[model samples]
Target: MFNLAAKPFDYLIVGAGFAGAVLAERLAAGSGKRVLLVDRRPHIGGNAYDYYNDAGILVHRYGPHIFHTNAERIWKYLSRFTTWRPYEHRVLANINSKLLPIPINLTTINTLYKLNLSSEGMQVFLAQRAEEPETIRTAKDVVLAAVGRDLYEKFFEGYTRKQWGVDPSKLDKSVTARIPTRTNTDDRYFGDTYQAMPKCGYTRLFENMLDHPNIKVMVNTDYREIVKSFRHDRLIYTGPVDEFFDYRFGRLPYRSLSFRHVTLDRPQFQPTAVVNYPSTDVPYTRITEYKYLTGQTHDQTSISYETPCDEGDPYYPVPNPENAVLYKKYETLAAKTPGVWFAGRLATYRYYNMDQVVAQSLALYSQLSELDGSLAQDERTKQSIVA
Candidate 1:
């Protein structure tokens, strides 16, 4: 809408997701700097983008983004933009013909095996079946060591293979380690202290965060297309690290996802928010019912079946030793590059949660604000929040 050459921006931030939006807000409002935020996609929220579907039911365009975090500061930082709807996410696994709680809880074990076991007995059952690995190395080991062969075959093996496009044994231990095994009947997906969603939705939350006059946002635009036009003091990149250098060390392997959204005539589709389909025979890994996440009462429910693929917008950086080594090469190049800073999951090549990304952007802002001699006042303001 305005002439790009007329004014120079204080920062050229690539990607209008959590990382970019947070920095743009901080630089503009905190240090009074002009920011140009750009995204290849036509929206600002990145993977967390949500909107009403054809059925008039709100749905996440990317997938189900359940916000949960243990860090109080991260929670407080995001809270400033949008009010939250208190929600604790719960997931179930659809194996055979029954629905069982995930994270391999006591209820899940008892239901799967048709054995009644108390919390203490549950531990004994698992302990007897668990095979302790002398060294835990890979994702398969993480599950095998915790639950042994039987549970691993049914619950984890196929699911991880389907999602990552590799056997769990070939992936990093951090992959399956993210999922926990419980002796208690507690079946909640995440055990974070704060679990909720933005009251107005993530897109609105981004709108509020980037509402500052100093931040100019342009969607459907790539940095390379306008790199020669707009002049800036610094660059903040949140895109894939490999692409930034034009894949010099070869493109780092990433896992992409495709969603098949189906709006049915029925009111409710599934019992819970998400139902994990761990069977490799099925193409989809999981099916999410949007009403459970949005809390919207609708006569027809919306369903999203997620299928992981190799071709699409990169959703996950493949976690393996080879890929990690390749990412390190790019990391080295990134450090050598001047006037550029890399942040967020894609740039760092770590599978970070949304709250973690927000925390990282906030930390970067603190670092930049200190360099600008504004940390002292900002620190005082930060401490005022009780949680």
Candidate 2:
């Protein structure tokens, strides 16, 4: 047991999200170190937070977070905190008054063109239409190389523009590469080996993970102020890297989102969990139904319409050459800054899923453990020399 009154906390973690929580838990349990975990938000779980609505239906406050990963170690690590509710995510894109499977699968092509295209026929059609660039540069090249101009214009262009607040041509190839074009009829959004939701909720899983005696949590507390008020040996920052360095080089661009949540008397809002609107007229990119994700049954259903914006809460880091250059400046600065380690999506300025964030946190913990062990050994050697 740790005596918080006697010993100061060894580490002070900035965000109470997956990165902060996972690192805090590991440091506290593994090294027997006291940790002070803080978040500016009133609650934990960061973007993955979910709660029950007035209708008694579980709804993700910040759009939807579907947990999907192929990493066995990541799966096993997270499984310790929460039981799994096996879920395979499916998404549909509303194009030309018709809903088609996203990722431009065989079904998506057949449905959109009103043609019976087999797997082989679909490949041939895509190849004939595809305009492969000599050197693929941007997000535009990725989609154009795979599905061609027509399908890219219809399904990706407007949606990408609306979602990122920029044209796909301006964004990095990795942005569109995240979504793959498939020849098979597999309608599932992600081809991850393990796909599931936490049985109780993401919040519950977080609560379980942070229940250690050595860890102290402070919600609605800013780390900046806490650093001024208290003393800590090390810092684990999961906030924006640019902000951490006070935008030394420049403010790295980030795409934010605004969600309009509505609870309807109807049992279901959409056909599936998420429906993407690829048309420019729609204004919003996608509408997500929570029950499909939570597997919750209720008389009334809750849904949220996601509208991308320039400012709200930073949801996605804008991936582009200019932003990459700016982030590199901050990355160099972070490396020079001692006793402070950065992790997670915002800190690293990368688009990472839930499991990826957890995996990253675990990896960071291992590195910290090694560093701590070396420091302890040096201290012991110094004390022996003094003796």
Candidate 3:
């Protein structure tokens, strides 16, 4: 048996993603504890990894991750690592051989329904166009209520069906309920107080954050193999809760994505950062031009087309009744497991943005520290009795 006493680490954190890195930083910096962060993948930034392509253009290797949040604390915390670059994410949808703004705005509805009406007229038209449902409960219900059956089937259904690998009709109300219909012509994707990307890039920002002397990172190392040997007072796990339990109850359902990153020998490919393809025939959800987000005026640019696939790394949790039930079982098991604390997207099984992850990790760190102090005091009392 590997001796746990041989290793010299205070905290063992799983998955060097946002949650692990942030927690490690807090424990090491705030509490002055030695920390070891491990990731199964041989990378630091996790899914938000960015690198320069052959064209010398900074590109999102996984997919586009635009940092936008309303949380002031999160913005202030992230500002310590890297300088912010102003980035407003705009989305275009290719429909009926024309590229148009999304969110089914006045222009979108007018072009889609072929109505030459003013903003007020568009609002009135949409009132008539909107489907009157008794109660909106499912994804279909929520979308159908905003834009009528015609627009719902045309814009949301096919795209969502391909993206989640489930019929929109079967999805929960919250799955697609956030999408809003606009009478005015506001084409911006998100409405957040802090909407910007790192000027240098996300990887560098993460690198700077995790580069502290008190923090130790082990990439391409599974926690299971090392946890038996490594000596740590506490654990901060950011990996899947199901994985932590070895999926004893059952695997919580998660949606995975496949990305096809390509390089184009031009300054730009599309006009905007992203173009949503809301059709099953397209085979891809959206195409993101990296130059738009990076603001790099290179001779050539890079783009990534997202194709929803079954087999890849788990990205998003499928928020359905069956998965919810399974997750509840995992939650119960996670609570029972002593010395292991869970946080982050996969562990919590929630759809979280970057800033949200950082904020959640910070909160988790505070709780973990308090728990550690209490446990240390209890252990010291027990040792005094023996002495």
Candidate 4:
């Protein structure tokens, strides 16, 4: 167990990601409380950390995390951290060595089917080929409904199987439903109102978020070891909820990631920053080139290849009915745990992007602060005693 150097804090926040950062900022700035933010990683920004690579290009440490959200509050909140760059994410799929626009757009259809069909014609063609699901239950239902049997089988099935270690037919519909299909030729991946990356980089943004003097950061520290000793009146547990209970019920299933980052002595690799290899034959799911997102020009560039492995850092929760059932059990166990509020992707066991996690953390912080009157009363008592 890693030992602490100093005294405990007023608020002990686990995981200095979006959840802990938001809560720490709120309690430290708003409540005037001392908050200690801890993370197991060596850095602050959870999966959204970005910094200048060896080639001096701003590179996303993890896979590409494009900030896109329809939530006005989320957009406004992150706007404080860094300036926004106008970037709409476009992705390509490498199928049989031929690059095609993802989401099965009109252009993709025309290229794939070898027919110069217009938008309307493409729509009609897809309707003819699309398979109507019996009940529309799984990821298979979602893909078949959006595209068709042929497109679904070609693009999604193999990818889904390799990515999640499960057949699309057995997974939740929302898993594949995330990939949108368009009648028009809009090649943008997300159809959100706001989509952009930080002009300075995500690491700087996180640094700004947790720069408050009242907040203390302890990186490479697990919450399990020193949580009990923290002199905090309230605790925010943002790590795995099941682990907190010592897996009294059972270990919650988590889908992990093994990223293979390669630095090439080339200006560019692919046309876009992201290229999805939706084939089982390929060991990796997607390859993200850093320069495309940052618009940085250099002789060499760094790219991260996302390989969905069964081990390494847990990135996603396998969305299935059985997992949901287990999550509910964990939730119940979490709720019963005193002085601990579970938040963030890992704690909640939900797959959240950077923007979603920020928005969620912001909202959750407000709710927790407003949950009880003791916090307010304690502050008042401190002020009165000071007087």
Candidate 5:
């Protein structure tokens, strides 16, 4: 804990997640400035935190977070903290009592209908069944425009509904756009150039990132409680922008998730790390096996079942027209608020993947560095005038 009576920090970062941690590290290490980082949660790494369970297997507490990025800079920046384990994530959807490859690839289509369609044949088949909307507006439109109703119903519709607690037709197209339809037999979930996980786990990576002398971390401490006590030149807030403003423009809607973790006395449980239950009959959206993700050869394996809900910790920002309008108002307010900068998924009200969040944070750091340089130049100019 940092003493208030000590010299004031250069930055008071709220939320010890990626955004806050990245900024804290950059401001402290890069700029030689003091930074105090705090989080409401008791630990670091935010949702990406992983720990050894009773079964001695490493598992993500929030869910399975597989890091993949096309950005070389982002990948290189994170590599400083921890070594990498090359991992390509694959997902299987339980449809018609069979586990089929997700992303609606050629193999998925062929396996589903028992037709060995070539790549060209798969494209032709999709084209024949595709429905062109007048204007592609919603998640449903994105899918129907490519694969039509049958595949959409089987793969996305119910799973999306359960995941977001809303119908695909009501959500933004960006929601479904994340999942691509491959004409080829590529079964990998992400097509990024770099796909891997931290070899030691995400928590240790965060620990390395925050292990600088200039950084002071306080976990299980909310920023609101220390706002009056802590003294800092600027604020880097990574919490919900709506809540930070006290919901002056009304609360922004968010979809939360409940995770149920179970340990099984087996070496392996699932073929893949993740399996999606797209059927509406299933209560949970997906199940993630830890051994598959971590490559842990444990006698007992751990798995997590995700159940989406309206309450609990905010995970997904409800992406719809109405919510967008509301977030825009808050965004406008955020721009005018002095001494405070917002970044990350919650702060920006966008669904960002793990690597995307890191990229955003690194970008934010660059912006902050430029701003600081400009401020210092202005200060020097004023001193010259005074002289």
Candidate 6:
């Protein structure tokens, strides 16, 4: 047996979230390398962590993480650990005392305008109102090109302002482009080929993934606390990129969220999984009912109210010209740093869905494996590596 105290660990993974957990499994089980996975939180699943509340209801601690993916390989990879429960996410936008399907679908438009129209008619109606932008450069531009100002104001403007702490016109097009407008009445939040959640919850899925003998886990301990004492050949960093470099190029802007969780003594609280409050009348951007996402039959329901703010744990990277330029500086610096690889949303300063994060970590592992010749060329890859 390999003694943990006698020799250096092969990989020291920071953050036991999706990026770190998936990569740690790949490195330890696939390559037979000793891995150390550490998280600042007292759990292994990171932000996707879920647990049973006082009422015995399963609730996501941070927010709802509904798994959806177009990549078949990714679905297959995660399926190895736990069985899945089919789940299709749906959202509603509360507008002017009306609850309508979001993504501005046909049902949403008809309900808002009180008109009966077919899919083709809906397309024509949108085309008649949408203004052709001279150049689509900003979030407001994208919104106006798809739907007119009236719809934009009702469904997007106030929410964007509250969520990002800025007007839509000042943000990057990628911000609004993430949300799709449908001509049809399909109200599903994501149109991926695979949509499901772990049968036992994300925490259990993570437990199965990190059960390898070669992988060790430490929680409630920041990497900085144990990094100096622990000897590791390579490092996988999944934290904020700016902090790693000590904000030398100045702090990159990020939007954080404040979540308020409550377990109500009722069978259900909302009609659907999530309801978006685009109006500025409310402080929160959205409210999520975990029972809908998890499909748990419980007398008491658990929900989370999300308030986006400038403070708290960074949840979203603010996308704009200035922030992009700042992130590039950190990226360049990371490339030069030896034996360290940055992965995940915060580390790369990009907003990625849970599936995308998993795909990225898998791709990174492949690159490392092929380039390092099964880690025989570890000394060389350590110096020139850029992930």
Using all chains and alpha carbons, the TM-scores for the candidates as numbered come to: 0.95, 0.98, 0.93, 0.93, 0.98, 0.96
- Clash numbers, per candidate: 0, 0, 0, 0, 0, 0
* Segments of candidate 3 deviating more than 4 angstroms: 1-7, 373-387
Q: Candidate 2 has what TM-score?
A: 0.98
Error of 4 at 63 (Å): 1.0
- Which candidate leads in lDDT? 6
- Cα deviation at 238, candidate 1, in Å, is 0.4
lDDT of 5 by residue, 1-387 (tens): 545577988899998888889889888889998998999899998999999988788999999999999999999899999999889999999998899999889999999999999999999999999999999999999999999999999999999999998899999999998889999989999999999989999999999999998899999998989977878899989988899999999999988889999999887788999999999998999999988777778788899999999999888799999999999999999999999999999999989988888888888988999999999999999999999
Tens digits of per-residue lDDT for model 3, 240-266:
778778889888877888889888777
Stretches > 4 Å off in candidate 2: 1-4
Pick out the ten consecutive residues of candidate 3 with the lowest summed lDDT. 1-10
lDDT for 74 in candidate 4 is 84
lDDT (Cα, 0-100) at 233 in candidate 6: 89
- Stretches of candidate 5 off by over 4 Å are 1-4
Q: Against the true structure, candidate 4 has what lDDT?
A: 0.83
* lDDT accuracy of residue 232 in candidate 4: 70
What's model 5's lDDT at 122? 93
Report the C-alpha lDDT of model 1 over 238-297, residue by residue, as the tens digit: 999999999999999999999999999999988999999999889999999989998999
Distance (Å) between predicted and true CA of 242, model 1? Answer: 0.4
The candidate with the higher TM-score, 2 or 6, is 2
Candidate 2 lDDT by residue in tens digits, 1-387 = 545567778999999989999999999888898899999999999998999878888889999999999999999988989999999999999988898999779998888888998899998999999999998999999999998999999999999999998989999999999998889899999999999999999999999999999898899998888786667899999999999988888888888999999999999888999999989998899999999998988889999999999987788899999999889989998999999999999999999888889889999999999998999999999999999
lDDT of 1 at 92: 91
Q: In model 6, which range of ten residues has the least summed lDDT?
A: 371-380
> How many clashes show up in model 1?
0
Q: Candidate 3 — which pairs collide?
A: none
